[model samples]
Target: MQFKENQTIYLQIAERISDEILLGHYAIGARIPSVREYAALVEVNANTVMRSYEFLQTQGIIFNKRGIGFFVSPDAKHKIKEYRRNEFLKTELPRFFMQLYTLHIPMDEIDSMYREFINNLTSNPSNQES
Candidate 1:
């Protein structure tokens, strides 16, 4: 995955792995790619991948199995959601708000747009069927 320069590469890699877990790509208790394998796949150094895995472990998103490889923690999905929500509030939301400010858009207008978007999403037949 292409990583942004705003954060460390290892952090971005961990976020990518968390996203994969959230999306069910890596189920709970599933074995994840080894540090060397992930480094080769993402074309990064093994140390970088190890750092990412360490971050995930600290966050309780995954755990090392000693003699075996790393496995997804049972709380991985919930942890991923919490992490993304914090990130959205801390970073993406601020950027979005700044963009609105630069565009001279009123807060009420933004709120209305958001509500409309949510309403449309909820009311869409395809989405409702899901």
Candidate 2:
């Protein structure tokens, strides 16, 4: 996976894992790939993936078994949604609103566009794939 410049590698890895969970790639209570395995797949250091796993564990997104591996929390989807919503509102919304204001975009137009986007996503099966 390509790492973004704005965030640390571990955090980016954590976000990628979260996205997989959100997309149902890793279902609730399902075992996630081991750190070493995932590191190889993503071509990152194992330690980085371990750090990402630790962060997820702290956030209650995943839990570690003593001798086994990490598994998604039963309420992972809910937790991820809440976490992402908070993050979007805190970080992304301000910039988005600033752009809208600078462009003199109407809220009604934004609302209409958002609705259309959602409709298209729901109607197009191909768009649902990662």
Best by TM-score: 1
lDDT of 1 at 8: 91
Q: What does candidate 2's lDDT look like per residue over 13-127, in tens digits?
A: 9999999999889989999999999999899999999999999998899999989999999999888888889899999999999999999999999999999998999999799
lDDT score for candidate 1 against the true structure: 0.89
Q: Rate the local accuracy (lDDT) of all candidates.
A: 0.89, 0.94
lDDT of 2 at 67: 91
Q: Per-residue alpha-carbon lDDT of model 1 for 15-115, expressed as tens digits?
A: 88987887788889999999999999899999999999998998888999998999999888888778778889998999998998899999998789989
The C-alpha TM-scores of every prediction are: 0.84, 0.77
Model 2 is weakest, by summed lDDT over 10 consecutive residues, at: 121-130
| Candidate 1 structure, TM-score to reference | 0.84
